[model samples]
Target: MAFREMFSKNHRTTDAAPPASTETGRDDTSFYDLKHKIHGRLIEETNLAALDSMDPAEIKTEVGGVVEYFLQEEQALLNEEEKRQLIVEVLNELMGLGPIEPFLKDPTISDILCNTYKDIFVERFGLLEKTSARFIDNAHLMNIIDRIISRVGRRIDESSPMVDARLPDGSRVNAIIPPLAIDGPILSIRRFAVNPLKMQDLVNYRTLTPQIAEFLAGCVKAKLNIMISGGTGAGKTTLLNILSGFIPANERIVTIEDSAELQMQQPHVVRLETRPASIEGTGTVTQRDLVRNSLRMRPDRIIIGEVRGAESFDMLQAMNTGHEGSLTTIHANTPRDSLTRLESMILMTGTNLPESAMRFMLSSALDLIIQSTRLTDGTRKVTAISEVVGMEGEVITLQDIFVFEKKGVDKDGKVLGRFMATGIRPKFADRLELAGIEVPEDLFSIDRYYE
Candidate 1:
């Protein structure tokens, strides 16, 4: 018998109702078999090579016709809605991200994590939950991974085994397979928001108070070098993007990242991304290389996505050498940890300077450290905003201008806290005034609390 005829015969034989105990198991197996068969038939019967040359709309129309013909010829038992859903899924498998396309389209889903072909999860509103999405098998999952990385001129195979890539819409994707990913092909996608959040949106989200936002805007406008510190997924990049909006449109800005995710609204912005080595293990571009190159570009401000290594030294140098208003992020739990992390990253540069000299350079180069935190309640908040006062003795002194004090957790598991001004005015206030920016004195009044 032909392929379609044989498939239909087997499907019909298994279509008979089974005993109660085995009914659910049989049904699941039958569905997987049917889906697999249909997917195979679509691949075999359709002229995918020709479809590739067509526009997206044309390809969808052509693929829909093929699916309709197959459904009719196979005489499959499915309702209209079921058949329509099947066509969409088949099209997704053909031209778009197969199983996770729905999650990518979902605005509320912030992350899509595929642990294996059979296991998948998504994060919505800061909480992770398992999703029904899955690949047919390991081979199926590998095909999708290849498709994603290849689009960005990158690859993942036994030779490399790991890669980072971006979707057409700028969503970040990381994949590891085989020897590196013993479980199976592992993929993690950090979806970029279709609608990027603004400073006012963050204020409404209670990430920070309006007063804190205002102060940050003033600091940015006054050209103070600011460093944002937080743990992973603590909203550091989001806050950096917001602060970047404060830069005047007239001044030029340079942004550097391993993957370009920052969305700057300023017109005079130049974005740079680091290049990984080619398959032959040549042509690698490091972040430190980009930072040193950015200085010669005459940038009014330089924004590093996150300084994780030797680039930290160049970033501090940029700030000390007249590149004011530079914004960057680092992975650390607190403001103090952020400073320590910077010192360690600078040390990674193999500089022979003593720790004291590094501390002095950090204190002089960075004027503010905005600390973000992800609380137990799944809400992100700016826990502390400190001014990097000049060195006192051998230690780098910092004065907290605003802090989030935790009172308790509510019955609903929500964090109960208030953002309060510590009463100690920032030394940069005079600098802000000198730059023709005026912030109300009461904005920093002692014991002032915002609930």
Candidate 2:
């Protein structure tokens, strides 16, 4: 059945129908039918291989001409505005992400999620809303997915039903097809901002106060090792990028990630990305390998994008040896949980180090943990700035330098809270002073919140 016909029977009174459905009933039905007819004709008439080699502008012009000719030939009833829109949609189908192109262009949309051919959702302001966009069918969605993965030198089929890739614009994409995906092919795209979020931008969004930001900048300047901890989508990587900006421009920094996402403006920076196994299941490079190799590159600082496994051990070793001002992120809810996660990841290396020794290593290496959280209201906040003082026996001790205390949610469900200093001065104050980074004395005043 045609897309319009599939929904035609369910239509109530014209006034009750959604604006899109009502619009479709009025003229969109004819538009889709005309679009379908023109698409078939174009497929049969155009030289797709030759068209691929032509410049994009030329291809668009040729396609536009064909669309105009088809409209005239078929005597399709379309107004000027409808014809223009149809042209754009047809061109998008030919060269872009089709139905999802508009969402990709929407700067406010942070994520595009496709659960099935007809079920499409977009996340805006941390809330998911169903979109009017959809695929024609399962086969149509799979074709788009195949095209996306193929561009990145990857493939997904029965042999390989799952793949992770990125768009040309650096948005992270993950797709899983059946039999792995029982519901249908699943595609999730985490869009990257065209203008990367800076520290001031984050402050404006109330992710962290300026005082904590200044403290973090000072820690980075003083060559302290920092780990950002958070759950998925909690803005951990974003904070890592902002903190990295504090590094001196003259220092050489090395960044390693599974997929390169960090946009560092530093002139002396080296970025490394891991490689997935080839079709023959050979020549895969893991993050652990990158971390181990970064040591010999004589980097003044090393930034692991995130320590998911054995790489955590190597990252700690780098910190314990000589590399300071190093930064990384991990998946955890709290500062303490971050340490536990690190300990678990270190064991994945098969190091067989005693628990006491591992705790001691963690305590010695990590100077601070900045815990980020996405609260119920969908606002991300840096909930804790914890200093890893040292090992108290087998336990790694931590003291909060700053914390976000929740009062209550307002009537509109907005979270009401304040970021307050813990009054306890950080052990690194002396070190920071020695490094010529002067933090204000009143910044740590008891119960005081930086307005």
Candidate 3:
């Protein structure tokens, strides 16, 4: 069966968003300042627990009363429409993170960035667009940051100037303050899907073709060790999650990540996340720690969100020792750079192993390297899928099985490219066959290309 036919049934999530506000003129500094003040008064007067249980309609009615009284007392001139906008802002502050709540709810927005109180930007459709969202001041931004981190059992203060957290919805968050941030608090959120992307969605977006997806699904079934390589925001984790969908549901997969972003749907999967150091500068758990411990858990497959540090050695150890269908992602501009980074990370363990020995070990463990790239035009594509054909001397060898050939840009500035087979049959084709998966000759035909 095709990749979509197999997995598309359970991959559904609501892609719809409630109607966005078309309200104008309220996106100014003065309006945010007044909204902040009224929110302060509402906090003092209104019962937060009661409001939390109230629906949006009830909350609107309750907030309208408090906001109207404050508007009258402060003599802030506003018409009915402006009052309604002000009420929404106040409710946002009370109910969720101020100014950013709307962007968090936006399905099209992949990232939410706060440079400072005076400036905020969001990544919409792989491009950064500045939003009119603002906090009253740096303190207000810091307060929002604190609320976010606190919910995750993490904190940010003068003693510890940086933190990594996630929202209630599992979006990745990073925040830095004064000494580290220099200007003001810097906040970044990496959003994931409420309903994760499926193979059909990737094919629809042209990230990959059905042929490539079918081949990757076969690789997963054959228990090939796969590493996804890409630069930042290149959809590495998203591909990881999609590839993970190909794993047999009966396997007890163990996933490790610093921020815990992978949404594995397998029934028997075990998810693990690293813990940051406490305020006392102790009680911290690293990815390396989890990788070492996951061994005792008898995982059928080990899925790492990414291998960036000394943990690379342990991850390689797991791959070499019966954890065959393991998957991981790494930050590199290309497939070759991923091996280089892995070698450096292994050396980080201070092991005196020779370079050739390490290369041999890496070559033996990895089966394929899939490269994901975000084009200049904000579209993401799987640029290359290379197979490790083992070492041919001191160096680990890699060959491209499939690649995306970029053919410049269109008049509308969208990227134009074709995903083509390299015509070279991978060594793992035999393994797929042995696993009862067919190896179609046309899958490796170089003459045919997908647009």
Candidate 4:
């Protein structure tokens, strides 16, 4: 009688149970268990090594088996369509990223930055925003990273914990793991658009006004040595790509970069990318290596992605020698500072050239400096277009043809700025005239110019 009363009390308590945190915990455990099972089976039946070697279609064939197994196992627990949906979830977790596939497919997302497991962000429409996607854990994240690098025949390990790679879609990737990244693994992906931006797109986006665009087009046509300067993520490469479109399509264009990112519209273009040192610390091809080799390629125009180190000296020499109309990008804050940065970078070459000699070389090789800035509103615009008139004694003389005057921000937090002519006509106008390029006579007139 006592045992029956105890059982009856227990049954009554279960029927009147309060909200159970354990129930929520059990649900999470079940989800993880299903994911783990799918992950294990994917590794087993997929012939992990062969899967690594297979083409995308073959890999998907293996992935389909894992998906079918997952559907079969979950069918009784879920309705027909729900089981089908679960199959997608399992395949996403096993074969590739599940819910984040759409974001990866979206061409507008130029970058995907992950600060942590939960704090994912993407750059879209030239702006960064937090994304609602994540990897299950660090292991899953590492697997994806490793898969990408392996396909490119690269490696990362304790001895070399950092890697730079490009995705099949031409997105540049830099990843660093633990000892170097104390917080967690960090990945920075810079996406490249398959379609190169046309000059009109730049004008429509207000990167530069139409008048400025016309002026730059004339400069390119006239074979002016141009240096584009900007800070990190300042859209230097994009601007360089657009400027390259100004080159006559028939000219033989050669491009050198640490990684091949520029997509020029020119017909006869050759691109060279640097290679890192191999595991034995031998057989490395650097930007300087390719820059020196590019000289022998008989290039009509040579464009370096960015002159960051000793290669600046080589680039300057190329420009000074017969490589007119050459273009490149450099990291700097202002037009004047760009000259200083060039000098500093050239000094890195250990040439031991006197500072005055370096200044003279730069003043002659670089005819114009275009300074670009990413404003507080995340808009990148060319702030100044300055002319290098040649060295004034020890100093490089500069004249600003166009200046961006900040008119402050609007109610929407967007920057308001105007590009105004500084009333100084470039001395290179004579060269343009000789090239049969017509410069608007009113371009130099203050009254006739539009602000």
Best-matching candidate per lDDT: 3
Candidate 1 per-residue lDDT, tens place, 334-424, comes to: 8999998888888778899998989999999999999999988778999999999999899999999999999999899999989999999
User: In candidate 3, residue 83 scores what lDDT?
Assistant: 88
- Model 4, residue pairs in steric clash: none
Q: Per-residue alpha-carbon lDDT of model 4 for 263-376, expressed as tens digits?
A: 877779998988887899888898888989999999999999998888888988999999999999999999988888888888778898999999999999989999988888
Q: How many steric overlaps are in each model, in order? A: 0, 0, 0, 0
Off by over 4 Å in 4: 1-36, 46-100, 447-451
Highest-scoring model, TM-score: 3
- Candidate 2 lDDT: 0.85
- Could you give candidate 3's per-residue lDDT for residues 100-205 as a string of tens digits? 9989889999999999898899999999999877888899999899899989799889899988988877899999999989899999999998889998999999
Q: Which ten residues in a row have the lowest lDDT in candidate 4?
A: 1-10
Per-model root-mean-square deviation over C-alphas: 5.2, 7.7, 10.4, 9.5
Sorted on TM-score, best first, the list reads 3, 1, 2, 4
TM-score of each: 0.91, 0.90, 0.92, 0.85
